[model samples]
Target chain A: MTASKPISLKDEGLEQKKRSTPMGDALRQFRRNKMAVVAFFIITFFIFMAVTASLWSNISFLDAPKGFKARHTINPAGLDRVDPYAEPGHCARDGLDQGKAWCALLTEEQRARFPNSCRVEIPDPNQRQWCYILGSDGGGKDWMTQTVYGAQVSLAVAFVGSSVSLLLGLVYGMVSGFYGGRIDNVMMRFVDFLYGIPGLVIIIIMQVYFREISSKYEDSSGIVGFIVEINKDLGGLFFLFIALGLLSWIGTARLARGQVLSYREKEFVEAARAVGARDRRIIFVHLLPNIIGPLLVAETLAIPGYIFAEAFLSYIGLGVQPGTPSWGEMISRAGQEGGFYSNRHMIYVPSAALVMLTLAFNFFGDGLRDALDPRLRGR
Target chain B: MTNVAKSEKVMTAPAKKKDYGDPIVSVRGLKKHFPIKSGLIFQRETAAVKAVDGLDFDIFRGETLGLVGESGCGKSTTGRTILQLHRATSGTVNFEGTELTTLKGNSLREMRRKMQIIFQDPYASLNPRMSISRIISEPLVVHGIGSERDRQKRVEELLERVGLNPFFANRYPHEFSGGQRQRIGVARALALEPSFIVCDEPISALDVSIQAQVVNLLQDLQRDMGLTYLFIAHDLSMVRHICDRVAVMYLGKIVEMAESEELYTNPLHPYTQALLSAVPVPDPDVEENRQRIILKGDLPSPANPPVGCNFNTRCPVAIDVCFDWDPELIEVLPGHWVACHRVT
Candidate 1:
């Protein structure tokens, strides 16, 4: 026994004194990818914008109407508001401001002081005036402020929805896979039944009905009432969470179940059983760590889908509450009105933002999969 | 290089056989059948792979009972079924005195303190994600045998006991070589101080040079701890040196059993004779001169084995009775048992 007992330092000398787990190594690999790093920073910037959405609305130069959530006009005298549709410089050429004194030359002095405040371009180069920046939707809301604040509502649905789905899918898949028999059969059959029904239609119906029911019960004093009031305060994002979370987990559940089923029969599990470890311990401690990598990659890639689902719902005019400034709602309101033909900026600005965030998530998810799974790395 | 060569020299040199005490583990009609279910809508059990059709053997205390067979012959199944790792289709495995087949939940776990298994593939058996310390101490932790501090000490002790450096406990399974990982597996099996161990082809996956060192380490551990082993292997020579008695299996049933040296020199069953003849002797003169009895035909499927003797399909010498009536393993010469109608 002594002949084979010596510690070979040369072989083990390659190992570091500090033991970093596989997850740590995967994180390091992910950091090394340039596009993934760029995507991560872009996503982080969106989250930062999301967190400071209210700050943008309050600090803008345009006199944002007090206590008005949706509309942002330039001043109290906005009724003769340059007639945004008729001509770009309708107020400026020959002083046709309807005898309003400030509109003539006093506004010219204010424009000279804060030139960056106006982002809208007038077609007339001779007499352009300061106006709504990034143009205005039909509702008169500023495009820049709407896009910035829309991140709050859009991101809330993205995060809370996916987290809820991940939770439910993990528990459902683990139970179904770990106790595979009549129980697994019954649980999976239920999922298959749910799969047969069109998921988007059900979510739409649920969102509409839940909003009605919540508004009706918001004053009562129980859990339902508490949830209703919270939903109202959250700009109807609570019901969005419930709708997206309950239905979207079906795909994740299927993914997780497959991962669990494959790892359940591996020799390490049999080894754990032979050591007298209980079923619960084997599933949670031993089985979970091995299967978690692929599940995580799948979830990351699925996040972009969640963001798009919210956008789709809002685009059809059923997304968040009315006053909540989601990019989808802005696009829907813009395009549904005559703004699609009249103002090009209103449609493309939010569309560009929507495209950027979702693309970043997709890129980051791809990089994560390659980092966590070596077999998929080069390919 | 000299260490491996010297150990190889010692391994092939047959050790003195010693007397064993009463059976520490006994099996009665052990069977393990894996059902093959087919059909899409209405699933039905069409057939079964009778891996261990029916086996009856005793692994005595302080002795190694080697179970040898070709790949599909159910040697590993016999060992796993005895330990209740694979639930017996129908049989009793009495470990010391407790009937292991009926035990479940905490009762089976408590009884598992007396028995353990060493898996075949060292890489597959140890979880890659877990550190080496966690792997070796897992059994002790599961059985609630010691406190956290105590388990750490025990892990180090077990590591060193299996001829591994205790300092390497923090490293993962991928860091170690095949021989070292096998030793780590050995350490895990020995964690709870089990009296009986099933070494399931423990050295087959190691290098030829590393194989000798691991085999010698197992021998040393056995002598010092007085542990019983159901050493399952395909290697006839390695089994001869390590095992006290050896059993030869064919198509899901044990065909012959006797002292290792006796079974090798005087094989009663035709299948065992064919198996031993296939092992080339080291001495060229004797190996060339020896009459080789190469049996014809591949082994019959265990799912639908031929009637009468399980080995009758490939058996070299067969009588008319060997095709109809199944022969029971009966003692032909006091300690030597053979299941063949042709055997007296």
Candidate 2:
């Protein structure tokens, strides 16, 4: 029976020859979770959209220069091009020009009120001349282009903000937890002080302060001027990254500090110390890797919070400067002068994107939590 | 063949006489007090936990010295302090004719290469994220000992030496059982070819069947390498099997010290006798009829140990002087030491 079992097991073992590493196991676990996989794909799609946003927006009909005539058949007058809010599928009315009888259902007064609304003329021969796929916003800009471009800003903020926080938090927490004495006490208390302050308030103050500094040196030609130039190119989003990163690190720092506190006592760290590993090596090589599982999960979950915070700040006019395309800024525009009722797509488009992004991050983060959990490894 | 014979002769002879010419490491009045603090904003030191208080011992060349005590008796702290893993609050650790406690920076790190420690928990001792090869090679990498290829070859050789399959080098610690992980740990400790190692309860966390295998491996390694060990454990039987001499601790102080055979056969200190009495004999008749000395009351907190002697609060043979004056560790017999006034 044992001989027969060995023969069967050998065949099975050959099929399972791929060695299972910690990372491989985690990836396998992540693949098994259906929702997390879907969320991961969604996030990947958004990332793709964010990276290629300029390409998408450049060709968009809604991305036409201000006052540029469409010169299309939809209306020789190009009335739709000048309108602040064009309804989606408005081009369906142009089919009336093909002599569709449905146009006759329109009341005589309605026909008089919108004489050229349903007219069809030859579109511009130039391929570049196109219309909004999701319709135009209150500013006569393509909603599709704005959305794609807006995604770039939000995603960048989340990625850069979270990375900055992770770096700061990892260093701060490692130093605090590893040194562990009066230095740890002082450092943690400082983190506690940071925790007490409202993140948005600090961000607003920093944004306003940096904005003044940037403007003051805008024209001066020196290192400060060079910084101003870079700041201008990034717009006020640079300040947003700084503010979010600086304030957001407290949570990650606390989590990292707690992890380090426990990990510093682990025998591996002692073993490392016993082997004459320097403090830097002990913290980075031995301690950090052990604590990384939880740190990664914490970082993943924190990214969505940064995205939401960016959107919230932008909505209140403290985020990206005016004229830069942002989801929150678009939502703010949508709420103005009853644009919400008239052009609901403008509001709904960015809102849905924001909601989906945050939800995707949350689901993906949850999957990562399960995948990276040490207790589940080797199974 | 002559070298092998000479080493064989060295191994059979009593470890105390042949290889114990001079102490490799000497610790004098070692103290490690951790401050307990209170108050949030303006913290105040409320009290100090004397984890290790006024310990003195010497580890000779190529001899295994057992440190036996119950949990929280500061045996682990003593081992760690001797290695300079934890800085002593006061006193000196003299290793290889240099005062280790006084050494700093590169000097201390240099000294560390000569000493190593095997941890109590094998699961926690090996980095879970690292492959066995990486864990074994980390010390070499830190010390800049060899080229990458050389390190890899050494790692493979070490894995084989520790009785693990050389192919297992690529596997993570989680894939191994407790015993295998411990072997990896031993390989790591041996990587630098250290003269001394603190086996901090190395086999306590292993299965009974695997415990003997690990101990035998250590013994074999010590024989091959001429390694000295401070074997810290609470398992008296296992300690007796491996250690040449043993030091018994209570609270934060050593209560007794002697040759393993003498200490077990004729324990003089009240605490040592009580501890030895608790070790169950294997024979059915002896196990059933052994006179167990159950010490009354729990171990007093090290933060507020009894003023006279740490063991006074729980000493079964306590006297008035035992409560008022601490007894020093004195040589009661040649090659035997005890720390109780009542013994005299």
- Quick one: best DockQ, which candidate? 1
RMSD of 2: 8.2
lDDT of 2 at B124: 86
Consecutive 10-residue window with the lowest summed lDDT within model 1 chain A: A87-96
Stretches off by above 4 angstroms in model 2 are: A1-17, A64-84, A92-131, A205-232, A337-340, B1-20, B38-46
For residue B251, give model 1's deviation from the true position in Å. Answer: 2.4
> Ten consecutive residues with minimal summed lDDT in candidate 2 chain A?
A64-73
- For each candidate, give its TM-score against the true structure: 0.86, 0.86
Docking quality of model 1: it rates as: acceptable
Per-residue CA lDDT of model 2 for B157-257, tens digit only, reads 88878877676678778777798788889989999999999999999999998898889889988988899999999999999999999999988888888
Candidate 1 Cα errors over 4 Å, as ranges: A1-4, A11-19, A61-135, A211-228, A337-342, A374-379, B1-17, B37-46, B282-297
State the lDDT of candidate 1 residue by residue for A156-211, as single tens digits.
77788778878889889988988887678778888998899898999999988997
lDDT of 1 by residue, B1-344 (tens): 34223323332333335555677987777789988777543568899999998777777899999999999889888887887888999867888889999999989989888888888899888887899999888888888778999999999898878877788888788767898899898899889888999999999998989899888888888898998899999999999999989989888888898889889889888888888888888999998897888888887888898988787788778888999987877667756778889986
Collision count of model 2: 4
Q: What is the DockQ of each candidate?
A: 0.38, 0.34
